[model samples]
Target: MTPNPATEPRRFLEHLYNAAVRRALPLHNTAAFLPPPPKGRTIVLGAGKAGGSMAQAVEALWPADAPLEGLVVTRYHHIPPRPERLKSRIEIVEAAHPVPDAAGLAAAQRILAMAHGLTKDDLVLCLISGGGSALLTLPAEGLTLEDKQQINKQLLNSGANISEMNCVRKHLSRIKGGRLAAACAPAKVVTLTISDVPGDDPSIIASGPTVPDATSCAEAIAILQRYGIAVPGAIMSLLEQGALETPKPGDEIFTGHEVHMIATPQQSLEAAAQEARAAGIEAYILSDEMEGESREVGKVHAALARAAAHRGQPFAKPCVILSGGETTVTIRKQPEGTPRGRGGRAGEFCLGLAQALQGQGGVWALAADTDGIDGVEDNAGAFVAPETLSRALSLGMKIDKYLDRNDAYGYFRQLDDLVITGPTHTNVNDFRAMLVL
Candidate 1:
């Protein structure tokens, strides 16, 4: 039975965001599948926005008889209020993200050191998540932190996908590409992660410090050059000579390494679907691995929404559409020649969708990074109600112009549509939903 259109829209959007957060929480879905407690000691080490929450979940689930203790790094303000006893077992340290800092480097080094002096009887429980790549930064022998900072800025502006960015990171870091797990000889490494990137390739997340890397050093060099990013001559020479080899699939270092994806964008989208159903609406998930230019993705979703609104071809009216995954934005110009824009993939996506939407009636949407901060900006993402563009016009602001410069955060903030959730203390990539009624 067709119900009221007014109430359906708001409830649909709420279900979508709630679904994203639900999937992020580390609830054990499968008890038997969890790794067994170690005979020796269990050392937990990880880096990412979700590190704190992941650690807490581990402590709550793991048997008390086992010796579980270690350290992890999360973005600033990502650490959750921990249970008193769990805090003593797992040390959560906050650090800079989307950019490396001294604290991150120090934490990376300490994690590597912890991997040392391990035996076959011991176990290393690595809790890796989406932002781990940024949270863990250990430069190669010749490269300085400044060099990494510069290259990172270039990549951010390049609009390269996470895979390409991670490829370069793996070769230049000592901790990544299964080096950490390799350090703990004979000790079994069990890595549990919440996959933020589509495809959930373990090696790409945090550059796969505890997992074998399929990407070669040559590929890394190619990525840098393909994106026109400059690297130090010494670094280039090393890559050219194939001296910086990351662990590959066949390497014995990962013999006993086991990785489990505890949560993912797809799961989050599903949660949203359940919420939609409860609200007397039908929900259809487009895809969990959507990728490409942020604007282009927005255009695609816009087309779908338009169809659903006017013709209801692919989907009928009173239905909510959802999708998840990371998207890239290529900055055409940087005024100071310093990359571009402050907002992240999520914010950009909303801008693209909003502009394409053209303030259509009865269609409300929301886009945000599940981890809270979108890109480097202060907001999780933004909201697009029926009057989104109309509201912007009331303030005499042009959102299209902002989109042209990759400045969605700036555009939305003016109208106060930016969704600021601060650091969600977790990341599952971007979550987007559009309700058509």
Candidate 2:
């Protein structure tokens, strides 16, 4: 039975979110993408928010007698609990994300070392998903880990899109942008990935570590210059000299390489739509590729919801509107001695949504990151309801102030509306559902 959205909107939205996540679980989607055991050993090397679960899926599927061993690096605390009887084969390690740390650097170096000495008969299965660009960090020549970290922070804060951020990442890293594929020269490299970006381009997913790169060093430099992000002088020289260029498409090293998108934001959004339909509620998918500033996207969604609620235009009553994609957040500068705002794209989205909703009747919504973390915060995201503004007013809270500071986390936490699902072990990026009755 479907929970009534009028009184149980949170539960209903949570159900839809869970359905979406279940559809993208690595175990549910990895089977067909798995290649046959190679003539030589099958070595798995991977990095992402979903790395732990993807590694576990491989361990569960491959024939017990087959030679399958590898290492995968996942976000800190992201490894799911192993099934009671499942034996561990892949060495799964934890590392920081959205920012690289020493552990991630070490893991990247180790993964690169492991790719060495492979023959043509061997198979290299790379399980990639969102967040790999940050998790698999190996600095380029003359660049230090600290330099990469600062650059990553600058790019992230500059509101650069995933592709742009990754373009810069690929040029500055030793293992990304097809360099990883080049390292495994004689082996057949297969990458099984979950798409989180808007277009599902393999080259942009995790910065295409195992696939050929079509992006150029000049493009990377242009992106950096566009965003006003800087690199070390020597690294800048390499960029100018084209010495930081990734292996381009048609490169001989990627001859036998294959990439398969096992899960994607569209699939997850469709799953949510199906779940809503199964519950006898009409569901409309806006788009799986929605992007732009988080707050602006939220305002647009509010307009649609308001239209549907007021005049039954575009969508009728009792409908759920769904969308999925990685939204960007541009952190606002705060005055000195003032506390920095805390929130991710999901939270900022909700804040804008609530402010624009203006306490319109009969609307409720949820916005969350599929990986269960929002911009380094513990909360996946937050919720919005018709009374959101009124409730805040009652608590002497002003919506515009929070929005000014980009403090959605603080705003939602006061309302006890933050969604706190921890590490779903898979990512197809953002999952949002708006219920208009």
Candidate 3:
């Protein structure tokens, strides 16, 4: 028997989302990049949303006889369940994300210590992905953890792009921006990364802990100054004196190191596009490197989707428009004694899309983070239907007011539209889809 036609659109959107995620799973993408057993012990060091899964994949694929031991850090509650028969050799730990904590500091210290005294025959396999910057945190000399945390909060709330934020993180860290690779000198380093940043710039992914950094300390200082974030006097002096510089592209420490992009936002978007075309709908991919303010990006997407839905220009009816990449949200200052809004880029984008859509018929949309968590929130994202605005109006929920408060979660929760897929264990940044029929 065939499924009902009325529910096909929603199901197709979900299928596309799943396809995008499946393409990024470590289990599916790690085997090809696995290096052969080295002359000495093989150590794995990693951090990100996909760290646990990447570790497990390495454990499953590596030769059972050769020695394999290491550690990886991931966001809290993101670790996947180990297989029943697979004995764990790699230690998987939990840490804070989008904000560093004591756990991350300890983990970073341990990882650095482990990299010390490695021989040329030893191998270091680094599994990197999105969110590693926060998961593996070690403050540079003279900078306290509290200071780093404050800067992180400020950058996140300042609407800085990922590149800008990471530029600052790389300079202020003791382990990021190829410092980890430098510590493993004499030992070959192999990095298997999942791209979550715009342009898939390896140096920007998790601040490129295992790759050479092309950004400079001077650039980082400029970003901080442009954003009006104050730096300590000592740190400012270090930056001005070029003492906080990261390893450049030709640094000797990266002599035997290599990096492989295992998964990317563009690949995931193409996966979703394949699913759309298989379902007999024309698929259009706008871009996989989109960046900017989340709400503003949503409004722009809404305009494009509306043009197709209303006038059938650029794209025809019965089509799905897809896009990927990371977007930022700058938290607004709340009034005195008012509670801060809850939601991340995905939900916020949905709010903007719903508002701009204006209840146009035959249009449905979904915006979600591929990692299954949007910002610090539990839900991956939210969905929008043609009646979203009208339903909210009926429930006395003002879209503009909620948007002003940056309360996408509150607005969508009341409508029962939040997408709650717990811990996808992989991240390729944001996945957005619009269906017009």
Ranking by lDDT: 2, 3, 1
Task: Give Cα distance to truth, residue 127, candidate 3, Å.
Answer: 0.5
Name the best candidate (by lDDT): 2
Task: Select the stronger candidate by TM-score from 1 and 3.
Answer: 3
| Candidate 2 or 1, higher lDDT | 2
- Reference-based TM-score, model 2: 0.99
TM-score of 1: 0.95
Provide the RMSD of all predictions against the true structure, rounded to 1 decimal: 2.4, 0.9, 1.2
Please tell me which model should have the higher lDDT, number 1 or number 3.
3
The 10-residue segment of model 3 with minimum total lDDT is: 1-10
lDDT of each: 0.83, 0.93, 0.92
lDDT by residue for model 3 over 1-437, one digit each (tens)?
A: 22222476566677788899999999999999998999898999999999999999999999889999999999999999999988799999999998999999999999999999999999999999999999999999999999999999999899899999999999999999999999998899999999999899999999999999999989999999999888799999999899999999998888867899999999999998887887778899999999888999989988988999879988998888999888999888889999889999999999999999899888889999999998899899999999999999999999998898899999999999998899999999999999888
TM-score, cand. 3 vs. native: 0.98
Kindly list the per-residue Cα lDDT of model 1 for residues 1-437, writing each as its tens digit: 33343765544565568667866776543243468887798899998988988888877888877788899998888888877765358888988888888889889988888989989999888889887776788899999888988888898789788999999988988888888888877899888888888888888777788888888888998899899999999999999998988888988878967888888888889988887777777999999899999888988999899899999879998888999888998886746765455677888888889889898877888888898888888888888887888888888888877887788888888878888777776678889999888
C-alpha TM-score for every candidate:
0.95, 0.99, 0.98
The clash count of every prediction, one per candidate, is: 1, 0, 0
